[model samples]
Target: MRDPDLDELRAELEEFAQPEKKASRSPREERIIAGFEEIQRFVDEHGRAPRHGEDRDIFERLYAVRLDRIRKLEDCRTLLAPLDRQGLLSGAGTTADAGSDDMDEDELAAELGTINGFEITELRHVRPSAEKRAAEEIASRQRCEDFSKFKPLFQKVQEELDAGVRETRPFELKAEIRPGAWFIVGGQKAYVADMGEVFTNDQGRSDARLRVIFDNGTESNMLMRSLQRALNKDEAGRRITEPVAGPLFSDQHGDEDQASGTIYVLRSKSDLPLVAENRDLVHKIGVTNMSVEQRIAGARLQPTFLMADVEVVATYKLFNINRSRLEKLIHRIFDPARLDIEIRDRFGNPVVPREWFLVPLSAIDEAIRKIRDGTIAGYVYDPQSAQLVRRGTE
Candidate 1:
């Protein structure tokens, strides 16, 4: 029951079919024929015919196998059949449809419906999870990208230093003697000759010792001034100057502002030997009743704050203990916001938050002994109850 016109079209197509040849055609001819054949096949498969109107040039290239050879009329008919079925060609395959190749933007817009301007803008600004993931991946990738660019410059400087090239000089010294001491005996020593020789050998030695003592005192004074300036620049010194003044206990009657505080400055125990001359001065600051300002004025000294008794209550371990837990064990037990938790070592060193606590010397010794014996894991205190609780015991 197939259409007679379609049957005729198939017969025409068979007639145009070229016999398979043992040898291949020239590359140029093959390329041209392949291009036109693809178009013809597309037309036939879709039940549409090929158009020869604007595509005349393309057809000519495909038919340019040999100018001398007779053109196959049946091949032309077969090529035109599909165009005729699709109404794309006027006569089988002579002309294309009215609007086949023309695409109107307005028409397409009408078919797809109007796009909202706001929606477009929103899409551009919005970032999906995938986009964030991609950005993180890109950043991580860039961090490890290349170090070869900087390696050469680094290696050159290292090599020069290794070769004994002088890169820097950190210190310099200048010296001078007192004018009167310049001429102790003769012509060049005439500066000191004006003075009578008042010393025997022993006296001269004593005079030298006196000069040494004066020089040592002067040097010590200068060094202390420098150290004070350095301490003023330290972080702890700054914090002490800006102490977070707050009320002590609920019933305490003393003016919070009247609370006396001191910065206990001490060189490390290991630095004791190096600072033997200042040992007496340091101890004096700790035991004396002089205010920090008065002490500094009297000795021209700068002191570091004593951080020994500060207790740190970390938020993470706030719940691990019982009665002495930071804040409280349960509701109505402690108000975290009201209670101040600071950590310090036994000898009173101000440790960073989450770091080891500095408690009184007495507490530290007991804590260490208990820890060594595996009796406790940590130390906690309840200010309200005035009690200390070990980690493992109730």
Candidate 2:
């Protein structure tokens, strides 16, 4: 016979061993759940699921992709039965990207998220662009075991850039894009250090292999022609020169090869109710080949202007710079603060004006400064924190 205390302890242990009523969700299931929640939030705010188009928010496009992937998974749909308040799993909801029950090409295009003219769908029957192919090839490159040999070159470049001894210039694609040259590819400073055996192509063209290293400690062995093709397609790509024989940051307007454009940050001068309400935080960013005044002179009548007078808040001059690429980068950094409201044109047709975000003026100024110093690449604007934060660790 056991003592009463021992018997009581054994009973308590047995009771504690019983499984709970709910099972913990797996990582995959959790992700599916979160994705559905995000879609529901979009539907709630916009009164519909996120739509597909080049002009639409990239977040919405990504959500459309996620919804398509989830809707096809029967297991996911079943798992989300209780958590899904929006009937996302019932098959009753139509794909946001997919057009109405009528058109054929659009029905397919909706799933593909075809932006502007670019084919964004994962499953494509058409041939891929040369840029896309080259980008994929470069992306597939693994870590370089010999990164140390090239590390010093990047260090020296950074030091010279800091000391104002060397300056970067816009890249122009040429056949002489050979080894021992430095270029900015894929938005990262890259150096071509070595060349492999030359080979002939079916078109009677000569090309050679190259060992290129990026400032981010990554390297690749992409072909020479492939690098040129990639650069030509890249609007922001540039080639750097070895401490050119000139004064640093000098006015090179007469050089004939310098970039000719300006990046202008503007704010509306309209007394419109909405504009008045968010005037301080609401800002528009754009690039113009002409003076900002010339660009916005007729803004009051244009749909792109949201029918408002505007004032230039800031301006950054450029030389051989890709203005569109720079504008895209600034917009991307402040994307989290993007305003979701739509506007109407003078003709009463609905207009969705982009490039406007709810960021503070000081933050915008700081961002532009960071861009000039070339330190903006690794940083992103945090709307919640209302400041810049380093990528990844955030």
Best by TM-score: 2
Cand. 1 Cα-lDDT: 0.27
Give one digit per residue, the lDDT tens place, for model 1 in 177-258: 2212211111011111122222333223211111100111111111111222323333332111000122211123334334
lDDT of 2 by residue, 319-351 (tens): 655556667767877999987767788889898
Q: What is the C-alpha lDDT of each candidate?
A: 0.27, 0.67
lDDT: which candidate is best? 2
Candidate 1 runs further than 4 Å off:
1-303, 306-361, 391-394
How close is every model to the real structure, measured as TM-score?
0.13, 0.42
After the best TM-score superposition of candidate 1, give how far the Cα of residue 38 lies from its true spot, in angstroms: 57
Error of 2 at 213 (Å): 4.4
